[model samples]
Target: MTTISDTVALLSFLIAHPGITVAEAARATHRSPRTLVEELNGLLMCGVPPYSPSDYIGLTPLRAGDDSPIELHYASHFSRPLNFTPPEALAIKYALEHFSHGVDRETLAQISGLSAALESSLGGKAGAALRSAGRGFVLPARTERMRAMIGKLMQASEDRRVVEIEYYSSHRRRLDKRRVGVFEIIEHGAHFYVYAWCELANATRHFRLERIRSARVLDERFDRTPPERRDAGRMAPLFGGKAKERMLVRLDEHAAPDVVDDWRGVEGVKIKELPGGRAKMDMPLFNPFWALGFVMSLGEHAELLKPTSLRKELQGLLKDAIAAHA
Candidate 1:
């Protein structure tokens, strides 16, 4: 459901940018126009529940195709935009700061103004909440040139342009060049990344922004099917595919108090508390290195209870390490 403020914002934006097509509006609002249009069309059936033609709001699409002009009528109720509540205002303050990090100079100044307005307008606990919230996020310190590169990538995403980049591969420990179709910039695990289709890998990949040595925007246009654009909200796997193995492990309950809590709500990870303060966990093994590191850190407190082959592999790695140290 769209919030009143969100619906109002959409209406206002459409009015300001008259004759704007669905795609253009989608890009500006950071929404899929397909979904935006559904929300817009919903406004037509809404109003005082008389359900009469006069009571219902009217919306007419003017042009053929989705390149249509929307006409709004019987909508005097929202003449004055609504004000945000204290919590909402604080939320906006945080959101503005989150986005201001990557915006250009002009937009950064505008965000600062909006932030100031929110602070002054808020009072009491709301102001405290805003102040209490800190920059809990850490973005890689980027040079001015890198910030400009981010701007170029954003433009390429909206304009469907491909980009050629010289990226430093951490795992390979080498610099490699690739052509990628820019999809979107997203933040995950305290770092910003460019989610794109890599022509070199022929797969969707997320490249950390700081790892890109250089980039050049290409003039050629690209068409991204709905499936091609990956969602940035989820933490992308480092290996770039589905988990290949499932792992079962047991923990001495007294040893790792927060371990169960840490994975409590995660999908595909389940825990069962035992009678003697022991717990068993079953989860998909996204990465063997990650799983091994965690288990090894626990020492005698943790045990791998399933997939004997994986345990054997870990033992082999441990033996190799011991031999090297010896």
Candidate 2:
């Protein structure tokens, strides 16, 4: 999905410059040149002209004249509103009312356009109940402190500034203060992570937002690396560089789909059907830890078919488990 900021940035760029090249747009937007080219090619998606190398930027009217300011008309089907619909707007207001702290009455009125009487009628207890229910029902609590921190981090990221943070790592059971160059915030499974280049570790790492004890924007800045290089370096180790070996497993028919879906992208997976309603799958092995655990999870339904060492390791683990349990 194109984020709201991306769309706004693109619109602002067009508004600023009457004529601009793809390269120029990319530089202005802090987006990759290739991505800007792709966006230009798909101008028709937004009901704009089939943008050419020589075409002027901005929303110019669909006419032959070159003197007029661009009066761009987006098709109704293509254009989405910057403002929320009634239900969405109401939901946002209710959420903010229920969960936000450090938000005063005037600010709430400004945000929700709700009367002071109505806001007060909701009361502190009602708001607390709403918040508790929202959390119970998987609705996120939009805390003011979290929003403020995220806003600061986003501004820092756009400005290419380093952030100093006191972070707590659950895995290592340690709290450390360090400076990190923030790149992107990624949402996964109902939580957010700040994926960044950790200067202290001299590598790319993901820091969970909730786990960050405290953060402060540092005056020091660093050059942002290209996104592709960051992605490659961060993802390559999952498959163990270039020297990893491929492993194959045989599964019963009932378990095949689950296994395939679970391990879809670690490496290329090949699934084959056996004559007796069983399935065989091939996948790359980064290390024996993951493969052994995966096969053991299937109980008796899965068997390691290749790489004799892996099968032997699994045999030992299974025997140990059985002995312990017995």
Candidate 1 regions off by >4 Å?
Answer: 2-10, 22-58, 61-65, 74-80, 100-110, 117-179, 189-193, 208-242, 305-326
Candidate 1: worst 10 consecutive residues by lDDT?
232-241
Give the alpha carbon lDDT tens digit for every residue of 31-71 in model 1: 88778878888787687876778787777753223766566
lDDT of each: 0.74, 0.63
lDDT score, candidate 2, position 288: 66
Task: Give the CA lDDT, 0 to 100, for residue 203 in model 1.
Answer: 73
Best model number under lDDT: 1
Error of 2 at 67 (Å): 17
- Candidate 2 accuracy as lDDT: 0.63
Give the candidate number with the greatest TM-score: 1
lDDT per residue as tens, model 2, 1-326: 56654464456556556466555656777877666555544453443356543343334333222333434334333243343333433465566554343243445456555534334445454443433443222355556666666667777888989999888864455889978988877655456677888888888877778778888998898686846754524334452344257789999977877776776564466677777677888866644665788889898889899899889978998999999999
Model 1 TM-score (2 dp):
0.66
TM-score of each: 0.66, 0.45
Stretches of model 2 off by over 4 angstroms after superposition? 1-179, 187-194, 200-220, 227-230, 237-243, 261-267, 286-292, 306-326
